[model samples]
Target: MGSKINDKRESLWQDRDVRFDVPLNELKLRNGERIVEYFSKIEDTKGNAGEEGKVTITNLRLIWQSKIKPRINLSVGLGCVSSLTNRTIHTKLRGKHEALYIMTKVNGTRYEFIFTQLDLELGTQFGIVQLISKVCRAYTSTKLFRDLKLRSAVITPNSKQLKVLSSETIYNKIDGVWNLSSDQGNLGTMHLTSVRVVWHANMNELFNISLPYIQISNIKVRESKFGVALVIESTDSSGGYVLGFRIDPSDRMNAVYSELINLFTIHSTKPDLGVDSYLEMGSSLAFNDHESNAALITTSDSDLKEIDDQHVAHQSDAIAAYLADEAQSKNNEIVYCPQLGLAIEKIKEGFTLESLWQVIPQG
Candidate 1:
């Protein structure tokens, strides 16, 4: 029986052509945690020239095992990771190499880890980074709730509450920013979850804003003289306030708006479904209707008729142009152009109207 087991192990090693110091099953995992991906020959930024290892990313933690002599093992819990940043490094001989910088918290102390020479496509790296960031955000949010003793602050229908969907750094414009410096806005981190949008200012730990999705009546992206702004209209007990955030990169503002819209839609339709189930159902529904109206909008009218003989292509562009023209006439009215997701607010004094356009989903 011993000889038979040894022979089986040798055969398995020969088939795979690689030895794993720590197998996937051997790694410690929390309940519901699972491995997401594995990458080989990843070098730690602080290690020796020839030091390389295999890196494994689980839903709960990141594990690394050195491949060379003096084997080293390291693990970072996802809950401890604060952020992931990607950068390009230029070497005299190696030219340009992509690197990933991971910021984590250990025993309340912040640490940074850099991994170089990652053999991943740009798109794949981006997707993986985004997934890791999302997991970390959810973990951090749970930790925050626990630390603040506000686990019951969010009133959910079920036990599953405070599932973070996305989080990003944004600037909150001060009311009197026009009279202040250009960089006068408060820098803060924003977290969007299934239930609420939370903002924590870097300078003010005691001051934070949390607004539930139910209170948010409308969300709009607008152009300001200084930069792009996210306009959130809420009807909460504070007598309802319009909050504006000036987000950098403009694209992030759009993403936040889209996420809010999705949350609003899901909350309105399926309030009972938990975040995980809600996401799964949304994916299934989207996959099943792959050739729905959204697909038609992307293809040209001629191609649309060729693909679906029963369907006639609508002149969406023409309608958009007409809407734009009509909006120009109504200078006093704040019109929301469906074609362009912008709220056409009247240009107030001391503000310059910039020609910015973005495509919005057809209502």
Candidate 2:
């Protein structure tokens, strides 16, 4: 079960009367298949007489380290903080059903031992909690397919020149006059679950219990290559201020860029790049071909080097570039799909990037 149990939300939560009881009949979920919901209700309550108000969150982490027979343990702790004032963090587990029903027809040998002990593996409340956790992992992974984690730093390139000022804080870092954005470092907490019951007929099928323990962890992402970098520093007997940023060339952005390049493809045989300069973070170069890629690398720990004239074949504009030598470059399975073409056009029009990322797949 590798999907999204809940999407990324800031201080959003919901509660339900779901039972943590295991060993039950075909359990039906009132809220449907989704086990958790995000941002159900956003509320702020003020405290009385200067007393800090208490808020209840739907997403809370509870750990049961060691368990004895007929004993249920649930320990709670804060995974993050969204408030600053007086905080009263609490954790409690309440049984949704009065009686724990056991199905006589269901057989044994259908459960997995807890992290270590088989004795603590099976129970009414604890077992159900484990199942819920497993379900959550599987559900979320399935919903959100894997994608590269921690897209671009989303900060000015100047900010990356120096690391975060402090290790503990996730705030803006100060480097003299430069405010390098803090690397909050994304938590690929992509709640993942890979069933490994090698002996079982199917991994999804929890043979022993209704719910099994699934692993949820922070994501390990791969670093993608950045775009080609060009250096054009003011030289000669004159000195001037320099400024530049980076071009992400992210997958989504590249897709649109390639689509647009296909337009008026016939007229430009050599190479011509028309760009309206807005932010002066980097030098712009007129490459000889649409299939150009550049990169700015550090000559050392204290210097900058630009990789120019790589002239290597790259994915600049797939559709149009793909037609560079073809009998007809724009005519193919791609252009035939009107819906997809329209979508690509919208991308060239520069749709709100922030809005599009909301639904973009994250690995």
Candidate 3:
């Protein structure tokens, strides 16, 4: 029966290729895996910073193919992705464009896919972001279900109540180095579920901590002397204490913050309120009055002569210089609400949690 079901799923996957121009072989899908969602005009962060492309999210991985000449291809395993969130970008002709940011677990590499040259209808980008988030959550849940072991065969009544929202193998920075050696920081698995966030050290199960969302008053990401860290402020019967966990690869920090915020909002008393205020906050952060200085591309006389000789050096140099400057500037600027940090602040300000659910696209 399982084999028959798998065959049916494969057939269904093949049938869904009516919209895609690329062949299935090019996608290189694994057995029983299928593409769930795809979008055009997706700009990759690599190379030109905004290289136009098409991105497809499958059960196994995200595959992106560049639309420009000398096509660039890349794929990221779903298991490696920490989070997917919506980002707003300012473009020269387009004014403002909504982009999808994919943060990975390794070295916190962030890939931005911008929706350019495409007319996005109302709520389109929101739907896309929500779909991506759901997919990531599903992958994380599946992984946790497989890896976490239990001693007893019988399940407790409360076992079903704990729904894993997100799980990842995170290294808790004890020392500055994450070498996985005995003297280095401990490595462990972290899970954010319906009730609380749990971290169990791989070396010792007893060395663990669980913090309920209700008790959490504040959660912030800041640059510390050790590096980027997630500081969770909570209050208990004994009083208040801050729990700090250093997440390496730094980029994955936002995703962790966003997941906690999402779970917290879901468990709030009133989940259907505060949509407008959250949108207002996001817009306020996105609005930048100062226009960025555009780069001037001037061709020297020798370069023009080289161009006549069909030499590509001049064009390559110009592109390389522009990209370097763009990267440097981005590194210098502070990211706004890297995760749902802003949303958490609004929640503390007495705003209800309605907007978050409304903004994120559901499966």
lDDT of 3 by residue, 1-363 (tens): 001011111211221121111332445543334455566656554334556666666555666665553223455666556445465556664456665655454333333333333446533443556656765655554432222232222112343222333322222323221212233456665667554566656545455555555445667776555556677655442136565666666667666666777676664432211111222332331211111200010112232232232225433442343222335434453434645555233232212344334344444
Clashes of each: 0, 22, 2
* Each prediction's TM-score versus the true structure: 0.35, 0.14, 0.36
Q: In terms of TM-score, which candidate is strongest?
A: 3
Report the CA-based lDDT of candidate 3 relative to the real structure: 0.44
What shift in Å separates residue 49 of candidate 1 from its native position after superposition?
4.8
The TM-score obtained by model 3 is 0.36
**Worst window of 10 by summed lDDT in candidate 1:** 1-10
What tens digits encode model 1's per-residue C-alpha lDDT throughout 107-197? 4455556576556552333344454554454445443221222123332235322334333122222221111013565666566655556
Candidate 1 ranges beyond 4 A from true positions: 1-26, 91-94, 121-127, 141-151, 156-363
Between candidates 2 and 3, which one is better according to lDDT?
Answer: 3
Q: Native-vs-model 2 lDDT? A: 0.19
**Residue-level lDDT for 113 in candidate 3:** 31
